[model samples]
Target: MACLSRHRHHHHHHHHHRAWLTSPDPDMLHHRPLSAHHRPLPHDDALPPLLRTPHPPRLRHGRHRPHPRPQFDGPDPIWDAVRQEAKREVVQFNSLCASVASIAFLVFHFNCVQAEKEPILSSFLYASILAHDCLEQALVFVLANRLQNPTLLATQLLDIFSNVVLHHKPIQRSIRLDVQAFKDRDPACLSYCSALLYMKGFHALQVYRIAHALWHQGRKVLALALQSRVSEVFGVDIHPAAKIGEGILLDHGTGVVIGETAIVGNRVSLLHGVTLGGTGKEIGDRHPKVGEGALIGASATILGNITIGEGAMIAAGSLVLKDVPPHSIAAGIPAKVICGLQEHDPSLTMKHDATKDFFTHVATNFRDEMPNG
Candidate 1:
């Protein structure tokens, strides 16, 4: 009985050991149920593609995928259009100048061939027209005749002026437009060559452009000097800091005073003695802002920081103290709005006559509105 009991006890111990090895403890298998501070990682689907660390699947076909392209912004369309127009104008003006020069050369050659006498006129023509290649070279030669002095030699001045004009694309465009403006607006300007060779208004504008460029570059002393020269030569006192735009027509430009803070817009016309000036001793921004397509008649004095509206007409000798409305005809001493203007630009028409009936009505209304005192 003792031997049988020993055998059963051994058998039971062996069975218990087998069961423990076959099945692990439930608490140990679960890994002690993660602590409150130790949370499980987020699923791959919850993360952004860039942040996710999952491996990409292998392609069945052996081809690789192409990457997507990046996008960028381009230049403004209006500015691009402006640039294109300027380029076209420059090309046309240059071509016209070249043709004129060519014709002049042919005439000089014919005179030399036909006449037996000394070719004095031919020599002059060769020096003036046949010698130069472009409008800019001709301008440099012409300006040199007047601008050369003891302190600044003609050659040195020419180099400086050429560098300024050639380096600046805007200056070239402005020059072409200014020439076109003269041709379009001034009756005296019979030809492009005549405007280039003779017009004081055109000359003054080009000098001012150079001075303005210098002023922007922080060479104020040289700019002021050029301004003084322009004033002396052309009698047009345009401050170097004044902002004048393209297609400007300064008719009989003598005594035209544009102040330092003045702003003249594109396609504007100003007759002789027109002053875009300050009213008093005030400092900052104390000048007139002349709008596009506005016409200021001869001797019109527009003062202060007021706006002369687009397509507005200020009658001759009028003194404007306040803002003029757009497309309105302003007249009288203090310059009241006499009547509304037509859709066309008055500057282009070169017309100063406001309707006589409209002027009469305005005068009548003014008298009626006045007190009995």
Candidate 2:
């Protein structure tokens, strides 16, 4: 009877070990043997492999492999290069202006000493140069010179204009490009210093940029005020709301008038007495959209929501009311398409001979003379 009891006990121990190995509950693997009521049912080897094995969260490749690191982090190289180039240009331009001012001071001082007179002009030059050490300071000085009134002192005006220029980086860049545009396009502009010091067009454009900034910031009263002063002083009446791109050449810019909603594209050349205006009492986007690299000759009047296409040329005194196609010449009153453009950008070439080209084409094509009556 004792032997039979021992055999029964061993049989029960073997059955429990088998049940633990083949259990469906993975928790059973980690825990100590459960109480009789809490024990899990035994599973068979015939159960599916997925049911038998628990899958932990995993990396995509495999458990042993590691993820790769990124090659770069931060600003892109192309943008970095562009920003660096702009900075270099600004520094070079400022240095050139300073050098020119120094030379002028020396020349004026020597002349005064030779003549045995008070160095009045030399003193003014020195003071001006001392007051304006950089382009932003110079621009503020110019604006203050014109815009200061009984209510506003030059210093007060300087502070306001300085804040607008210093706080906005794009305005500074635009100023640099504007200087470059003058040097590139205007044969009369001997250097960047000449443009900075003497070009009224450059002065007008920079002031307009400040006013435009004010307009965007909801200082409409101040913006309009600046606009009025600019028109009064420079004779260039560009509305504060007008959008003008970089590298614009407002050559001999006096009497130039850009309307409220006008949009002028990059590298455009507008000569004296040009009017980008509305027709009669019309309002709401009633101004021309002048495209990139276009040339508007002296006194050209482009009116009322018309698109002056890229690289198109408007002859002097032409009245443009319709959309001029890209790379074409529009001439005459109620301007007609005189001829297709041969040059890529007549503005850059500084050519105002569209009428000559038109006449030449007509002469060449119309071989038969007018029928002899």
Candidate 3:
């Protein structure tokens, strides 16, 4: 995975490298007509025309004459050529146009591969650059009509979703961290791109992000509609009202349910079939509040307003009702604190049957390897 720092560095380098293009040197001007001396104006012709001021301020007869400039009565070939070149450069650099061109290249590559021809690395590289938002765009397209507006175009849908979720800086940062969480925590996740594109858990979480934002903005109807689409598509039901922190992994997301008023903390891992629901008939704030770095195992049902403390680990198939202390392991029906974990964050380690301390295990292995002394 490429770090954001590296991307910023590259972007900075690109701007610095092209710094000269923004300010032309007076000794190399060639695009326009020569001055009063009939000698070419001092300017750098190598500078791209887009950055070069179209009408450069020139000194004529020792006076700054703004008008009576080199007038092209007809289409001057030199000016026309510069204008065409600038248009081509602008189109090439436009991100949206690049993305569209990338899609075409990807389709061509797919066809070539299907025909048993060799895949092109150059094509794949080009596609990867512009297709970073492909998954997000696809998600928007999938839920475009969820609001029941049949006349909305795909581009409009993209803009709507981008404004609500994708374009927000905080949401974008959360998504990158979410993808990193999937890559680091899930053994099956091959790469950052794989997590971004293929993981339904990731997809479900991102949709919830969009819904969560809309919900706060008082678009309750649209938020609920998105919630419905998420449940139908991903089998993971998280209420728009639920509060979830970043770096969360809803592993094997099928059948995972997080109810309204539920609070899941940062770096928490919830396995498949886990439920954070209410104890029943209570009106306000009934769902469980899971702490940061907590690991809830498969089929674990945590109910009420109980706190699964930070770094707590709940064993698989457990029924948790009471509050579980931090760094403790809870298990069995109506789960109890069976033991404590030496590992600081069980969510990071994902060790289910860790009875002894992690260091104890390491020391035991070391002892076994040593000769009798």
Candidate 4:
């Protein structure tokens, strides 16, 4: 009975800590309540020099602090490194979970189409599909070198993460802001971020990071092997040799083609069924070169050694055979410049929306020009 009474007295000694750091001036001094929970925040004189000096968490009564700065002496930097690495691992594990889930959902949906019960598969699929994009986005940040930028990285990362709770904003706004934040942090990120944004659903660079590791360590073949796996898995069909840029949007990207020696510029948009192809008998950089901010609309085929100039627009269903001028709107069987539209301007505002007759006339004229192949 005496020991139980003594334990209660001991508990009461630290019970005062709960309301300890409730100070109004957070900007000047971060006053945390004195408790085991507050341990993560520093206490007194033992703070890092960056956090040194007594910016004390004063009481509500405006009196000097009663406790010496809580001697913050125990957070092991080494352990902190371990914790950070663990955090990255958890993020990666979450990514794998997302990938697994997406694949499982696809499988379950496929099975549902057949009216079959894929029991074990269905369970895992439902769980995995839910987290698929979460992981993909997290993976996107992990590989972007965004974390290395320190300033912009934190801001952009927070924005990317905050998107989950930030209801009612267009996904593109979040994407664009994150990309801009990343670019402001580092210019080199322009290319990588562009490519990653367009190819957000694809983990191309994550695979490339692994491949790069192998290539530098004299594992050329092994790296290329992983590169092939990335292509097979992602299905966007980027060549290991092709150089791509940042802020790209590969919309509904299946059956999208990118050829060897192709150089893609920043902020390019390639929609579903778009082909950057070559003449069958040709080889060596003979494929189309996509320019920056250029939108290769759905089913737009740019064949042979054609350069679609910067900010150009290839209308949906257009097939290009010649070099397109910058900012020109090209369309139809043998594509022609019907008008000019800025790439940044969305399609609803395009003059072409008001000019379907012009495209029909051009299509009619061009069809007659084609050799009956």
Q: Per-prediction count of colliding residue pairs?
A: 0, 0, 8, 15
Clashes of 2: 0
TM-scores of the candidates are 0.64, 0.65, 0.60, 0.44
Please give the range of 10 consecutive residues that has the lowest summed lDDT in model 4.
1-10
lDDT of candidate 2 over 1-373, digit per residue (tens)? 0100000011112122211112222211122343444223224232222112121212223341121111222222221222222222232333223333212311012232332343243323222332222455555655665567766666566657877886676676577667667877899876555576578888899989999999999999999988888888789999999999877899988999999999998778999999999998977989999998899999999999999999999998889999999999998788999778988877778888658866566566676566756
Order the numbered candidates by lDDT, best leading.
2, 1, 3, 4
Q: Ranking by TM-score, best first?
A: 2, 1, 3, 4
RMSD of 4: 18.8
The stretch of ten residues in a row with the least summed lDDT in candidate 2 is: 1-10
Clashes of 4: 15
Residues forming the 10-long window of minimal summed lDDT in candidate 1: 1-10
- Per-residue lDDT value at 197 in model 4: 33
Residue 364 alpha-carbon offset, candidate 3, angstroms: 25
lDDT agreement of model 3 with the native: 0.61
TM-score of candidate 4 versus the correct structure, residues matched by position: 0.44
In the range 1-373, model 3's lDDT, one tens digit per residue, is 1111101111111111111112222211223443343322123233333222232122222332222212112222222222222223333443333332322211012233332342233223222222122233334433442322444443344445756654554554456557667877899875554554468888788888888998999999978877887788689899999999887888989999999999999889999999999988988999999998899999999999999999999878789999999989987677889787788878877777663454355568989999998
Stretches of model 3 off by over 4 angstroms after superposition: 1-129, 132-157, 355-373
